[model samples]
Target: MPTFTALTTLPGQAAAEAFVEALERLEPEPTGVGIFEIEDGSGFWEVGGYFAEAPDAAALDLLAAAFGARTFVVSEVPETDWVAHVKRELAPVTAGRFFVYGSHDAGRVPEGAVALLIEAAMAFGTGHHGTTKGCLQALDRLVAAGVEARIAADIGCGTAVLAMAAARIWGHPVLASDIDPVAVEVAQANAAANGLADKVICLEAAGFDHPRLREAAPFDLIFANILKGPLVELAPDMAATCATGGHVILSGLLNDQAEAVLTAYDAAGFGLCNRVEIGEWTTLTLLKPHG
Candidate 1:
């Protein structure tokens, strides 16, 4: 079976959502439609749809014009078991004291390593990406430096691996949140699979918007492995939510974007304590000034 995907980007969330609604009523009927905000601080939203057959270009064009969006990029996707492909391509990864593996590699966990089970899934952040790996290693280094945190939060936690890692190392409940509900569900499942369900609580939220997050303010440690734009936007909230002398681990940035993110945090009263580069991604460890 041939699968086709049509995607377009527009400036506002309302336009993107309207595009998705229009796509839902298309003649051939799409299999799925999604509207997502672009997280690069572009203030743009993406609308996409999947079809079992090639979508009508004329209809797509009309929809794009109506929504004031760019022309749809339509492409045929080869039929493949993406989950299986990910399992084969993503070998178990070891970063510092953490061992991230799918269930297929359960027996490969090294002795004395904190094991995190994050199966290949639709959600991102499996520790295979440099951003996730760098964050994990940063956590390890923090532990090595004898920094112990009793309260921790993982904002934008994709698979909740960082939250699970903190739970495993510190034996405390770590708040994990993501804007996507699917990712939050995946994080919850991953935490349960790793036997940290009791210690790693997952929620659907954007940054620190939830009531639970507000009540759990002043975290001793915080992890925000998101893009530079959001990282910069989050600086003030991070500063307010982090305890005095607390630590924060951040990633999901290109090498060139690190300084801007660091500067943003610096303005929010955080000093860089350490930086780890993995491939093109840079993870930063920062400390809030002690009162």
Candidate 2:
């Protein structure tokens, strides 16, 4: 069956969310509605809805005018096997000492490499994106520098790839958490697939709010590959939760936004140790000073 999508952008989060709420209740009834920040520092949010039937264009136009948003661009989405499409589009991605691939490419993993199996899914972090690959490379560099983390956490762990990578290298437990429950579920499934289900624990939490996360506080290493806004907001919590001399590897930032995020972490008591730029994205590795 063919699916239809209607998309538009608005100035603020509240307006975008409200638009989605109204869009869901439209005559045709959307199958799903999604809202996300554009990540361009423009403070604009994108609102989109998927429908089994073509939405009423006039209704969409009225909704856009009411929300002060751009006119909705409606398109028909052709029916395709998305998983097979992903398998064909994504080749194995290798970053430093890590190799990430789907089950179809299992035979291609290089020997002695830390391998992470991530199926193509609705969630993010398959180690194919620059942000995820950069983070993996940073992890490899840390290992090269003789850094061993006994207690580690991966914030916003989408597929739990980073957390599983750390666990495979250090032979220790890793806490992987994401604000989205779907992401947490996907992460857990990926962990089981990688044979690290026992080592990488998955949780649903927003930036270290869980009791388990608090109990695992002062982590020796942490990975937060989320966007700049959340990274800046979580700086204090990251600092407080990170052990002195601990390391934090961060990404999901454009080159221009790295300075502001670094400044926030700097005030929270972290010093940059290394940086990597993959395309427009920059990944940072920082260390909390040891007194």
Task: Go through the candidates in order and give the clash count of each.
Answer: 0, 0
For model 1, what is the alpha-carbon lDDT of residue 171? 98
Question: Can you list the residue pairs that collide in candidate 2?
Answer: none
Candidate lDDT values, in order: 0.91, 0.94
lDDT of 2 by residue, 95-171 (tens): 99999998888999999988889987532688888999999999999999999999999999999999999999999
TM-score for candidate 1: 0.89
**Per-residue accuracy of model 1 over 169-208 as CA lDDT, tens digit each:** 9998999999999889888898888899899999999999
TM accuracy, model 2: 0.96
Worst 10 residues of 2 by lDDT: 119-128
N/CA/C clash count, model 2: 0
Best by lDDT: 2
